[model samples]
Target: MRGTPLRGAIYGLLAAAIWGGMYVVSDVVLKVIPPFTLLTIRLILGAVVLLVIRWRTA
Candidate 1:
């Protein structure tokens, strides 16, 4: 009950942290991998992740 007020702030910090990590990883990956290839990989990975999440929920 006491933590209710802090939920939004916590989620905001988590989102920032996730995005910062992605930026660092993308910077390193793009040096060796082409942009289109990276985009394809990200799309595939996102699809797999979403599928797994959906399967689990069902």
Candidate 2:
């Protein structure tokens, strides 16, 4: 697929939404977990979700 400008903008907005939600969730998780570790877990989860999407599409 071509990396069209509009496609990039849409993806960027989606990523921003994910990050915005992460900030709020991380704030709540802060009560129980350290920030760095919480971020690590979030990263891992995000990676898994992306991988699953790729797998299904491919």
Candidate 3:
């Protein structure tokens, strides 16, 4: 995988898509929540999700 350029490109595209989706959702949610509050909630939820995934895989 280290030397595979296509695999890296795919990963990059996937990451961009995920972030793009997050931005669009956050944009819509901004009407009901303040920017700081939204950001805080997103950070906490993202951390929890990553931790859960790590725990499960480990």
lDDT of 3 by residue, 1-58 (tens): 3569888899999999998898788778998899999889889998999999999999
Instruction: Give the Cα error of residue 40 in candidate 1, in Å.
Output: 0.6
Best by TM-score: 1
- lDDT at residue 14 of model 1 (Cα atoms): 97
Clashes of each: 0, 0, 0
TM-score rank order: 1, 2, 3
**Could you give candidate 2's per-residue lDDT for residues 1-58 as a string of tens digits?**
7799999999999999988997788678898999789879889998999999999999
- Displacement of the residue 35 alpha carbon in candidate 3, Å: 0.4
Q: Mind sharing the TM-score for model 1?
A: 0.68
What is the alpha-carbon lDDT of model 3 when measured against the actual structure? Answer: 0.90
Q: Which RMSD values do the candidates have, in order?
A: 3.0, 3.7, 3.1
Cα deviation of 23 in candidate 2 (Å)? 5.3
> Model 2: number of clashes?
0
